[model samples]
Target chain A: MQQTLEQKPPVSPKVSAPPMAPTFSIPEPAQMPVSADYKTVGVPLVENAKFAMRDVNVFYGEKQAVFNVNLDIGENEVIAMIGPSGCGKSTFLRCLNRMNDTIDICRVTGSIQLDGEEIYASKMDVVPLRARVGMVFQKPNPFPKSIYENVAYGPKIHGLASRRVDLDEIVETSLRRAGLWEEVKDRLDAPGTGLSGGQQQRLCIARTIAVSPEVILMDEPCSALDPIATAKIEELIAELSQNYTIAIVTHSMQQAARVSHRTAYFHLGKLIEVNDTQKVFTTPDHALTEAYITGRFG
Target chain B: MESSVLLPVLALLCALAFVAGRSRSLAVAGVGGMRILNSLPFYYGSLTAFWCALPSLAVVLIWSIFDGVIIENMVHALVPPAAVEAAGGNIGLVMNQVRNLAAGHLSADSVEPAIAAAADRLVALERINRWALTGVALSFALIGAILAWLKINPQLRARAKVEDIFRWTLLACASLAILTTIGIVMSVLFESMRFFSKVPVTEFLFGLEWSPQTAIRADQQGSSGSFGAVPLFAGTLLIAGIALLVAVPTGLMVAIYLTEYASPRMRNLIKPVLEILAGIPTVVYGFFAALTVAPVIRDMGVNLGLDEWLTISSESALAAGLVMGVMIIPFVSSLSDDVITAVPRSLKDGALGLGSTRSEVVKLVVIPAALPGIVGSVLLAASRAIGETMIVVMAAGLAANLTANPFDSVTTVTVQIVTLLVGDQEFESAKTLAAFALGLVLFVVTLGLNYFALYIVRKYREQYE
Candidate 1:
């Protein structure tokens, strides 16, 4: 019990000692260790932060989806958010670029800053902000255009390419970085959607990078892909970590371990733990995190 | 007995057959119950029901159809060859007069003794035919029911047999609908052929002058009718083109605004309002076109002093086209809106995630994705505009002027067809039969347009799936 006390941070609730549960059967809310007022455990802060969130709360209509949470994405770092379905990990990821603004009834109350600039400010425009923070989704959604146009979509919209030659070069370079230029070079005029699933996702990634973004937020980028396709994406993610900051929300714990440097685990709208990937998988600080990692419960 | 009454009696026998077949199948199954039976009792019941009804219905229908001709042949036998030859051996003419006499619609004094004697024979033969028909049909129904009852055993493949009958019944109904369409088309084709016999096909197809006014009597003075349909075709294309011009942009904008911009409350309020525009009778639009829009356009043209370029008639094509465009806005909006809304969410989000604005996403991703379906919708709308008759009839005047100008009075094929059939004219005239020829052309054009729309829509569906 003393060791358990040491396990918890100072922000643990004052109502009672940390709650404990038996080995097998599902428990009541009271037996759950995490409190409503819980502050995120482990290293949720960093010095070289590219994106940071503080006291964030998200609601879909009357239902609170994400409770108060604080976390930071370091510069050029890969952080994977792992959680059960409807745990608000995706919602939390969307706050970085204010992507949730598109959802009509979803309301977010928090201070989300990118490069010390508050992204959720009323004055900030999402177009430029999103141009800086590109996103890849769970499904490989390539635009219904030829491969050349699909990669050129971002640069054209942003006016980054003054000439057709410039656009072509950007397309080739972006696809090269995404590791897709070799296979698709012969068929640049072919429809982007006609490509294989893995290729399509990589095309989306190339399209994202063509605008030269500072950060890439991916929501389960490899979930729809086959195992080989997923491994290729993991490798791409590893290579991409050298140049761009990435915040990925993934269902696969092993994927988080394989690609991300730091992993954040959320449960029931609260952040239970965020730590170095190896520490989280080997010796998690929070008992709830251990319970989740060992497959006791999501 | 009336065949309508016979139908009910046969239906009652079918019900009895259903019960008998069910019980017999149960008896066949014995202590083993339904487990050992090839099919359930339900299948046996329906199988017997169909057997009892179908064969008897077929026989009764065929008998009723041919009995009139058979009895008429018997009546013809009653009349001597001399009387038939005097009537030019016209069996139909003699039959009509004989039928009128039998019904007492014509006096016996007006006809010769041979004709009167034949009319009496017609009445007797008809009475005998009815009794014989009822006897044969009822016996067939009873025999069918008994045969079906005897065939119902545990080993019988009652389910499969019943299913086969159902499939054939559905196929029969489908064929009937298609056959009726073909029959109507054939009648039109034959009449058009008669019209072509009077006027050359090339002249009707490519001639610009369309003065279809022919002399009423042999000595009467009138213009020799020239059935040049080009002027009518040009007017249709012009008006339909103008309508498309007005409808396509406005309707596409409405669709985009609804799908990409409108709030749920606004969408709900606006969509039904647009549909109400569609539901408003084209006749009502005709009234609006003729009374309101046409005069307004003429006055506006006068105010603008546009007479320097072209004259503006009260029945200008612009007015009809504009009002027609309004009438079709709901169609364009409804159909295109369905496709636009069906633009996959992932595609929209992908563009959005790339930092593109809503309008940019719509322009670059959503619209391009849905373009084939949108073009299909526009084609469908064009077909409707081309086929629209009431507005053109009321607003567009019946002047077959082969001019490209919209301000001049011009007439469409639909309007010409309407005018040709509206008043006192004999069906034998090329002028009257010209309506059927025009109808055939319009049918082919609309059929082509509809087929193209379906093909494009199917192509768009394949892209997404």
Candidate 2:
């Protein structure tokens, strides 16, 4: 066992100790409390906020999906939302770009501001708002077009490129930024769907960045990929956070700790804790966050 | 015994075998317990019923099929050779007369002596045949029931045997549809070959004239019945082209509206009402085309005062094409609607998240993703339009003109087929056989269209996770 531990490359120096500790200290399911209240406002305010969401609530028809949640996404910083499945993390992430408006039954009641301007204002058109805030889905959804066309789709639609050469440059630069240019530059005419899952996801990221959005929202972008592919995307995310504000929803606590600057923990549609990634993973302020990160129950 | 009684007696034995087998299993199980039985009791009962019923039913079927032919041959043998020779190989007519006399529907005074004697023999032969069938069928049923009852034991593997039989029965049912399709193709091919023997294949395919009016009497003037089918093919294309032009845009727009824009309540209400257009019988559409649309078009043409230069016949190709388009709207809209709805919500969200408006999302993402299915729907509508007959028959008169103009009278392949085959026409004439030729060509065209549609759909299908 000692030889095996030395043979494996470490993910992090801090995360290795918790699993090595005795398992008996973990609480039994029967003895644990049935429910725990969450903090409603977990470190909500940031000094250089790119997006400030205060008291957000989301509903799907008669069912409330996300309870009141207040959070701030800082400029050029990666904020990762981590939770169990169906904990409303993805719903909260969608609120950043108002993507939930596409769903007929979904209703939002809160003030979501981008650059101190209210997004839900009566006259605010969603077109330019969405151009400013792009998204990547959990499963890669590239348009059924050529790789070049997929990357150029956004810039073409928003008229970001005035000429064919300009469109070509934007496509090349976006794919390069997403770390897919060298592999796909020769076959730009190939359909986007023909690429591997990892490449397809990168193509989606490239498409989002073609319009040069100020904020990029990603929902489990690497959950559908292999481990090698996941590492590549994680690397891409680390590089991308330098130029754009990123908010990602993930089930992997380790991924949050590795990639994001600020990590937010959600449980049962409520925000439980928000802090720096290392601080939250090493010494969580809330018991629920600790239980989740330690793999007690989802 | 009569066959009607024989059938019921065999069924009764089968039922008895079922009860006997079930009780026998229970009794055998009693030696240990119910768990000792290899299968459930019901399977054993059904297995016994099948064993008893199947062989006996086969015997009955074979006997019934052969009985009529064997009796007819014996009756033919009874008729004196010279008298049968005098009938000039028209034995079928002679059999009909003899059958009428034996049934006592014909007066005895009208028939010849040889025929009357043969009729008596026919009656005797039929009775003997029935008696023989009854004896053989009953004996088979008895043997089967006794054997199956004796075979029923704990180690019989009755469930496995029954399941094997069930599998074979399902295979048999599935092959029945394939076999029927093959049978139709072969019959049409033979008839078409017969037609080609009379009219040269090149002329039938390439010749432009399509006047298929062969004189019934040799003395009748004009109409030597040209077998050229180019005009019919042209007419079919013209009418179908007009129909596709009308249907494609309208159907696609309606689909987009229903799937993308309409409220759920509005969609639920409008979708079925549109589909009701499909449920309206083709004959009803024909009547609507003939009585309403054709007259309206004519009135409009007259009001425009273009009647002097070009007469818009009440039965214009435009009228039938328009009505057929309306008829197939549900076909296109329903299929396209389903495909559009199937485009993943995530793709639409991805586009909307890029600041694309609803219409932009539809055009760039949803429609392109759904393109293969949308094209498939259009091809299906085109096939339906090409094969449409009743509306074309009533509204577009059966005058196979080789012209592309929509306002002129025209006829489709199906309409010409109907007119050529209807009423009193001799089967041996080239005119009647030409119908089969036209049908073969129509089938080929539609088959080619379907294949092309499938090829396009397969080549470009976008598989989403």
**Considering only chain A, what is the TM-score of each predicted structure?**
0.90, 0.88
Best by DockQ: 1
Candidate 2 segments whose C-alpha is farther than 4 A from its true place? A1-42, B85-89, B462-465
Q: Which docking class does model 1 fall in?
A: medium
lDDT of 2 by residue, B1-465 (tens): 686798788888889889988888888888686788898888888887888888888987887788788888888887776666677868877888899999999987898898999998988887888888888877777787778778777888989999999999999999999999899888889999999999999999999998888887889976598988888888888889888888898999999999999999999999989979889999999999999999898888879887877757878998999999888889999999999999988788878878898899889988988999999999999999999999999999988788876778888899989998899989999999999999999888899999999999987763422
Model 1 clashing residue pairs (backbone):
none
Residues B256-297 of candidate 1: C-alpha lDDT, one tens digit per residue: 999999999999999989988989998999999999999998
**Of all true interface contacts, what fraction is found in model 1?**
0.70
Query: Candidate 2 at B283: error in angstroms?
Result: 0.7
**How does chain B of model 2 score on TM-score?**
0.96
Q: Model 1, which residues run further than 4 Å from truth?
A: A1-33, B1-4, B80-91, B454-465
